[model samples]
Target: MLALRRSLIALVAIVGVVAGAVTAWVVTEASDGGAHATRGEAAIGGPFELVNTEGETVTDQDFRGRYMLLFFGFTSCPDVCPSALMDMSRALDRLADAAPAKLERVVPVFVTVDPARDDVVTMAAYVENFHPRLVGLTGTPAQLRAAADAFRVYHEKVMPETYFGGDAPERHEKGDYMMAHSAYMLLIGPSGGYVANFKHEAGPAEIAAGLREHVDAS
Candidate 1:
């Protein structure tokens, strides 16, 4: 009985060590970029049903056969959002002169993360400051969540006090909150597949170059 008990304990110890080793290997592989290594393409961009600036219902299918350059942010964003949109607009303008055919196939899109404050009228007024062809989209909270999740976007509302700490400015109104979101611009292929992403700091020239490259490749 003593020998049998000892053998069982030994077997359990061996099994635990093996399990730990397997777990460690998986963690190392994932950290080393093996998490996305197996897939042929990154899983990003999917079907989204939303409302356009004109108060028209739009969906991912509406952009079929056309490439989409999309960014996610709130209209009220003071810096990052406007900067990214302007860069995108400038890139499209460059493409218009450099590659008119490619520019025709591309569409710039802005999706609002703060649906509560960014209604159709607000989006309409906001997009006019960017590219002439820029399309602004907004929807209900649940609809927005679905779209954001499909694109792997992260967004959260921050209050003045929480964002500015003890010296936070007084709120202009009860709904006066700020939205924090990812600032990367995404390029989607004509068939609605993920192509590439431009960093938040990417300039208009860089974005245009990327767009030209990917559009030509597709």
Candidate 2:
């Protein structure tokens, strides 16, 4: 019985490691070049209804005639979220300088994973700090989940203790928690299909180039 239990534990550990490795490989490949090349066959992205910064309900259909550059994150994120948004903003700026007309056809959107704290007013204020053309979106938990699911985004709330460990500061309130989420930005075509993904590490110029290629082709 003891031997069997040990064997099961070992098998579980191995499976966990393999799953993590596979996930990392998929994300890396998607970010590198596979996403663009496999866009036609990729099943990512679909219909979603969410609220805009103006408190008006909006759907994916509203963006049917234009390309959508979508990102998922929260406003209060201390580092990753803000950095990713800044990179996206810079990429758009680069695109504007290269192809002004194409820039007009692409809409950069920020969707908050923490809808409870990211109301329309909060979204509006947060998005304004990024690209002028960037639109902020937040909705009820169910609505946001639908949108996140459509894009295969991963997000989970983590308490400071779990996220920061024993070194966690005392300044965090009892309800204060952080979100762990996927950092990739997704590109959707004018007809509401997945195009490609940009890794968080992808720089402004690379993203701009990708945008120019896809927008020009579309």
Q: Please, what is the whole-model Cα lDDT of each candidate in the order they appear?
A: 0.79, 0.80
Candidate 2 C-alpha error for residue 6, in Å: 34
Instruction: State candidate 1's TM-score.
Output: 0.79
Task: Show the colliding residue pairs in model 1.
Answer: none
Give the TM-score of each candidate: 0.79, 0.80
* lDDT tens digits, residue span 83-152, model 1: 7899999999999989999999999999999999899999999999999999999999989999987876
Model 2: lDDT to the true structure: 0.80
Backbone clashes under 3 angstroms, per model: 0, 0
Candidate 2 residues 1-218, lDDT tens each? 32342344334334433343344333325655565322123556789999998889999999988999998989987667788899999999999899999998999999999998999999999999999999999999999999987777777898867555444578878889977677778789998877777776688999999999898533
